[model samples]
Target: MDLPAPLQWTEHVLFSLLLAVVVRSYVLYGLTGVLKDLVKFLRLLPGVDTLIQFILAREVQTFMNKVSATPVDSEPVKKAVEIPEKGCSAEELLQDMAELKALETVTEDGKVFAYVYTMEDEHAKTLRKAFDMFNDPTGYDGNDKPSARENVVNQFAHTFLHENALSPMVFPALRKMETEVISMVATMLNGDSRCSGSLTTGGTESILMAVKCYRDRARELMPHITEPEIVAPITIHPAFEKAAEYFNLTVCHAPLKPDFTVDLAAFEKLIGKNTVMLAASAPQYPYGIVDPIEDVGRLATKHNLPFHVDGCFGGFMLPWVEKLGYPVPPFDFRVQGVTSVSADVHKYGFGLKGSSVVVYKSSEIRRHQIFAYSSWPGGLFGSPGFSGTRPGANIAASWAALRSLGEDGYMQKAEQLMKTTLAMEEGVDSIQGLSIVGKPAMTAFAIMSTENSGIDILALADAMEARDWHMERQQLPNTLHCTIMPHHIGREMVFINDLTESADEVRGKASLSSKGTAGMYGMVAKIPDRAVVDEFILQFFDKAYKL
Candidate 1:
């Protein structure tokens, strides 16, 4: 970056001018706008930049080793950094890997909240058995001709676990099973006969697919529109932001009302000509508060825009919860102006992980979700979603969960889960310093500290974590989230007792003998400089991969 020898003095003047410009920009627009530019331009100041890097490196190391949770170590699963010269037998290797097994959360007792959805041991065994049966079957051979035994199991789920969905023609069974799964989800959500969608890896992929579909749809239909935008509530999942970033679309986040629902008036105001799509959550994850989907649908219809209902959290549970005589509102295809819906089978459908469906109102709109290429040397290529090699076992197991549960089984579990959800809501709200955030419509809810409550909510969460509870900490008025299910049936009383005790401990901790570190659980909420928080999180993710 140095200039020629004769012009070295001019470099100092140029640097000073650039520094003034950056400082002015920071003062005018704040860090979010100028932070990146400042980094790029100021990196040339070696003395100052070196000091900043040293401080950042030390802080990142402390954050990783001291503040963050112990990383799930991968060392025990391997003998060395590279593959072994001589591999050991499967039985021997598994026997030697006790450390890896010990590192897993003991979720079997249903103590862990998120990232697990097991109904019963027998249920899991059934799905696992199905996966094993279809994985690596002896039905295909690498020869000039097909195997002689191919006809024997042609009608079965036909080695689908090992089949590549990338080529549906080669694996018709995978196509059939996936089609049926999608159809079942569509019908369950009350999509009419014209409903069409694709199986995705998870809820995020489903959301991304819907975003891409509408973005492309606008490109074709509104050709004059150059810049695209998405309008969704602030409570919408982070996946929508990811989609907007990837597709060069601007996302206008609508504010929230007192009830934790999206402010419908502000939502409508944000939708202008460039708004290509609208999204609302059915029981959004943070507070389990279902946005007024029916009202949003009205706005969408009035504006003639495509609307998507993110039913990832409530899709499977709300249907049955409604059938159980609960006051669940319309949030699915039955509601008018809902052009597409995303539901996660892995969350409450009691299926294998990584299975979700994004259903559109018609095949006409869903067609835009597909990607096809013709000029590649690898032959013609097309994929339904982002994934090329999908696990057929997920599709089959999802089908199995829906078919096996039926209406009777899902209803039974829904009733119990709803009972627990309501009971916990009542219990937690009655606590001295804690209150439920809002009137939750379904199985999840958030507990926040009251305005005058002396309790430090994050300290209470830290105490809860000490008792082996995996607390999902949330911010912006700082709440702790819990997603209760059938496994949480009889454990409500104990959970309430622990939370009360934790709150008590937090209230008494202000009189410590010596000063202590700020509650790490709540520090992110207190930090005003979002750039520093972003860098800290970036470094945390970097550390996660090393272990």
Candidate 2:
């Protein structure tokens, strides 16, 4: 029987898959879970022969936010019109904003997702005022001149209004403040003088810069390999996958064990000649279990690879947890093989959004992250980190926020957050059909249906959402995520009550699983082809901008 080229290729894939399965079941003599991880190393095309093996399994998908046909809080614009015929009065604009603000997702429940919600409204006021004053950069004909307003803003925020971080020579104050910020974060992470990094816009930018640094470094050292790869746990942040997609590298995901930590043996096996970098998460987002950083660090040392610990979720809070006497594993530059570490200052550091840091073990390695071009019309052009026209206001605001919290404030908040999280964990465990995922090492954890409980966790999320409690939905085991903040401290019982009611409401009603947000994620989870999944997400994005 004559077969098409694609079919023949599929045949080969299936044959290999079957042989691997037989070896695992018969020859291997143990449910090691390494075989599937080894199969993940293969970069197959068009997604055919392997379909049978993994049609029901989760695909290696990439997305900033999950696409839902029935998206939550996607309030449509009130009305569409051309550019206004006349400028509206300020009073009219404020009235319009007030009406819109009333429609916010958080109702009286106040269970909105701010795991470390602190000083948000206060910091937001400064940021808003700063952004408002800079409506048009050109409006500043006399903007450079100092005023009483300048002193007032500086006294509170230290913001360099209308300032650009394009060139530090032009804004020496920004350069100095940014230096001290980096140094402070490095010292907190237990790094010495050798530690170096840049304050990026956010955690994504920090991770992107780290990947770029190692990729470029490998280009110089290992030029023979055109396509480089990163070996990381499946639980690694999607930013790494995003980095790989942007930088033309592959992310080989290793499987997790029963506890949801990366299978270290499988992780080590994935490391080959082409592997340029290794990454582990400090309390990875889904499970909130810090991947075995010390073990991965040892692997990085043995393989002579640059390791990155993504502490974006835990970086700011871990030290406080450790000081509070929580047994946190050493996850910073203190580990021998940990070459770079990323932490989101915007998260637990109490900084406003658009602030994160990725520190390195040495200045030499950090140098590769910088981009420069001499032959240009603008003369020597250079950018460290992603943004060229970086906002000086963000740097100033972040600095102010950090200084305001100080060590004592953060520790106090950590104590509150830990107490709330543990309480929430116990409350969640008390639920009959639901369970918290993994041994949560920090503030975040996911709630999942217990095995054969017949509880659709996604349906439970919809039930919570309807109650005006902003919930986070997760997959790869179908769960809902929750992180306890200071605000959540007194409201554990409220959430627990809502959760218990939701569970009871959904019990024996399997039909609810095919409705609303649950239906969307459930449908997507079953698809094996990554291209199909990509297209499904693309349609959601396309529709968003269809107007």
Candidate 3:
């Protein structure tokens, strides 16, 4: 083996190279096998499917704890108990509710803004009696107590309760009420006699229905199109976004002009064959400025697309405001090419919650609002709106509220609300470093501070809250909002005094910290990444369910 030293050295070198290659290959194969085993072990872990759920639960629980720490009135949790020896009297339940109501600070004569639209004691008593008379359990059975159910309360209950609108044959009254409500809203909006529509749960549902209708209509007209879009002003309600998410539609938000009205030129450029609907708000929620619906309607007509007027906030009030001689523009079906409208009866309609109407120009258009499931075991179910079983009591209460507040009653209330709104607007405008947003003709208005005024709107909101005033803050321009009601008429001076004092105090502060929505909105605006903002919102919802 040691015959020649050089030959021996060369052979040794070759052997070392072979050994190195083998070691390297073995090392790589071991690493790859270990990784595969690790992945398999992870998959084999017991209840691994619940890993994501566990993480979500922990996150949600943490969020809830944070939310619970915030100072806000929360209802006590009432645990349901098995029937003890005997059931408690109904009177006891009523007493508990009364005590809870007494504890509530935002009742009538309280300085809370907009929530409780109180009337005279006499009127309240009348409404209470109406509710009691119609609150009988027999009210739900229409055929059994036809004559007793003839009144608005019983009739409304009979129309909605146990009577699934999903089955028109089983419940004809639901169909009638839905038709009548739509027709009445259409008439108020100045739609032609041929106009029609469906009843929805609220403003959001009505808006959703309209968007869905337009999306389907567009799909039918354009078979080759997979992506449908809607063009709306930036002021449009967020419900449109929700609709777009559910129906897989795109939204093009046009900016507002300097005066806060919709920029028609931007809107014109946004519309294309894929554009299904064009939306305009009658006194949008943020600035309370009515979009130029007439101009928007003209554009929609030119493009052969349906125009939707989102009057959910102002629909019930503006018609009466116009009758009272307030300067309100035509933002309803009166405008040609305006095909659909959403109006909430719960807000200005003074109806109980869970009632609103979405009206259309014709039966053909409204037919799209229907949801039919013929193949289901439930037997040819078809609901006009989203819900399966709606509370008849709400419908009855709405009917009662509407009938009680006839045209004359509405006119008087509208006058008072308009007067109070104008007074507040004027008072805020007079304050130093404050300016009204736009020419609002109804019960809502907003105020923004002058440039470099050092007045933080969120700080002012907190200050107002300290005085028991629940004024809301808006984003984008960063302003404070107020929706005046009839109850606010005599309290204008009190509000003005508080506003002036709050503005002066907040302006003097070195730093302002936001609370509630104001703080959330502030953070959202600063976040450059929209995904992070979405996460924040999702975390907020998770927080809402905390104990």
Candidate 4:
């Protein structure tokens, strides 16, 4: 069987090549099998079992704890042995409401920041009168009166309440009010006549609507996209997180620069084929610093994704501020690529709570915001928002708030608010231990203590509370926050004086301790596992309803 030397060499080479192919194929197949098994094992772990359960548990626990720990409602009402068999008199109901109001803790005497947006007695009376005037009109129920069993205020209480918005003939007034509100807001935000929107319950609903609209639009335009995502700065409201959770969208949070503005490079890197929306805040909630919306708009244009400006906090402030000659950025439909915006009327709009608007640049895009069901026994039902039946009173109140505080009034209020805010900013900056977080061009601002100041901002907040001033404490960088309102204009000096004294007192303490919900927030910030924080939030909600 011996052959020539060349032929023998060729035969050997052929055998070696065959053996190499077999070995390589087996190695590749084994690696693939191992990877599949590893993925399956990871998926089976308890930690990854049910994300919904994990997330909801933490939120529920935190909520419960808050409800339970509220000290104002110490006496639980007991059931009566027999019914009165008749409705209570109006006077009796009024008396009961007054009693309940008296039981509420007065934390608004400058002791708390951002919650109440306290007003002077005269202003309070005015607001009350306005509220009473429309409380029964336009078919809206009272918010929290004397009775708990009354379903009159349960969103849809009037005869026209259950009428379907899907059919314009059934609830024409609802559609009209909704349209007018959107038009008014759009005009205020410098949108063209073509701009349109729908009324949402609040900022979160508005945000969710925008997300869903953009997601659907993207899918229609680009059929291959299977996974959609949103790119937002870390400072954007947590409502976006809720939207992502509910819509099965991935949220990529871009980092903030040292000054607390969105990092442009990081934002760009996070964009991919599946990114359907880009979000920027006009004065984000944490530090109240407006992002570079013009730049973000440009990025959105380049990426061909919808740009959403979340002006829930500053929607009413920015236009007036700009008119006041403050250095403001373009944050509305005027900016190209800014397709949608969410603004809350309850915040700065001075409307009663539970009203917000989400506007889009064009009615074409807004078509996606509508929800419809064609196959129900109740007939074809459709609504613009998540709720089945919304309160017409809120709509009416929103209209009244806007009409009452016309452009002139809003401008004046904005001016006063800016003055107060500037004064507070200067006061905080003058303090040895404190520094302003960012250049707050609007009414909202934050302050943090330096290491040299020997003051803990959280402790300072607690001390301020002792002085009957309520200021919010923020974590990420450990700061104190304030949102100046019309009522705070004249009281600026009082707040400054109290804050100065509080800082001094906090500085004297060798160690600081946070109590109550403030302590919970501090602890939640330090926890590395977000799941634990979620549980704490849930507990707070649960505690809120304890009787």
- Name the regions of candidate 3 deviating beyond 4 angstroms: 1-164, 513-521
Which tens-of-lDDT digit does each residue in 385-431 have in candidate 2?
88888776677655544554567767877888888899889989999
Candidate 3 lDDT over residue span 454-506, tens digit each: 88787788888989998787878888888886457688999999999999988
**How would the candidate models be sorted by lDDT, starting from the highest?**
2, 1, 4, 3
In model 3, residue pairs whose N, Cα or C atoms come closer than 3 Å (at least 3 residues apart or on different chains), thus clashing, are 166-382
Model 4 per-residue lDDT tens digits across residues 437-518: 8787689998998876777778788888888777787888888888887557577789889988888887856457466445
lDDT of 1 at 385: 97
Clashing pairs in 1: none
Q: What Cα-based lDDT does every candidate model obtain? A: 0.74, 0.76, 0.71, 0.72
- What is the TM-score of each predicted model, taking all chains together? 0.71, 0.73, 0.70, 0.70
* Tens-digit lDDT string for candidate 1 (344-385): 988887666688999999888998999989779976677889
Evaluate model 2: give its TM-score.
0.73
* Superposition TM-score, candidate 4 onto the true structure: 0.70
Largest TM-score belongs to which candidate?
2
**How far is 243's C-alpha from truth in model 3 (Å)?**
0.3
Using lDDT as the measure, the top candidate is: 2
